[model samples]
Target: MPWTPPLEADALTTLLSKVQQWTPFDGNALLDDVGAVLDDVVPPKEDLDVLAQRLRGHLMQLVNIAVTAEAGDKDPEADRLIRQAHTVRAEAMPDDHRRAVGHLRRLGWTVNELLERLVAANCLREAA
Candidate 1:
């Protein structure tokens, strides 16, 4: 069956797109905030790249949430933003990439849905 992106995934994608053009300092600041949230959920890792990738994944989820909040209106820009986030997330996280592909085979979740949950959980850590 074809993969269906989850609502959360769509939200995160939208959020990321809005912040993609942020200044370097702004991006770093956002990453730091996201990292702090993710640290609470995912185990501490020695590899900075791994940590950054995970944080990026979380940002994607935020985008999905943002998109969903703005739903029911004509927003081609939001759709474009979500797609850009999808591309970045797919390329950045190897573990997630593998899990997403595996999901295709086992029917766990569509790539989009898996990404959404992964992102949502990380985002939730900030709240918790």
Candidate 2:
């Protein structure tokens, strides 16, 4: 299914809750952290189009990282791809997005692992 933009605070909250529930951390703590972060974000008007786009970019970066990591050591091309991904992430993310990205980065998760987990969470959320 195509991604749907979050229109209300409740919707975003629900998404956050769903994502947090699927996270590896203690469910309560993850939910609390997600709530704290959501409290800071200014709700997007009409749609979460910008946030969605930023997330898509982030996902693509993770894909690049996964491919590079799987290929072994950092060659010139891998280095260039990683650099490009970092640049895109820096340019696309806002403060809350940065925090979310930072939290994930600190988790010591590989790109493929993150992608798989996120996709599974999103799928489950949609199913629910």
Pick the TM-score winner. Answer: 1
The TM-score measured for candidate 1 stands at 0.32
Clashing pairs in 1: 10-64, 11-63, 11-64, 11-65, 12-60, 12-61, 12-63, 12-64, 13-64, 15-63
Candidate 1's residue-wise lDDT over 1-128, tens digit each?
99665569778798788679453323344445444434334333344355445445454555656466553134454455456555555553335644433322221112233334434444222232
Clashing pairs in 2: none
Per-model RMSD to reference:
16.4, 16.9
After superposing candidate 2, which stretches have Cα over 4 Å from the reference? 1-48, 51-72, 92-128
Model 2: per-residue lDDT, tens digit, 62-122?
A: 5444454552143454444444445544453334645545433322122223444433434
The 0-to-1 C-alpha lDDT of every candidate, in the order given, reads 0.44, 0.42
TM agreement with the true structure for every prediction? 0.32, 0.26
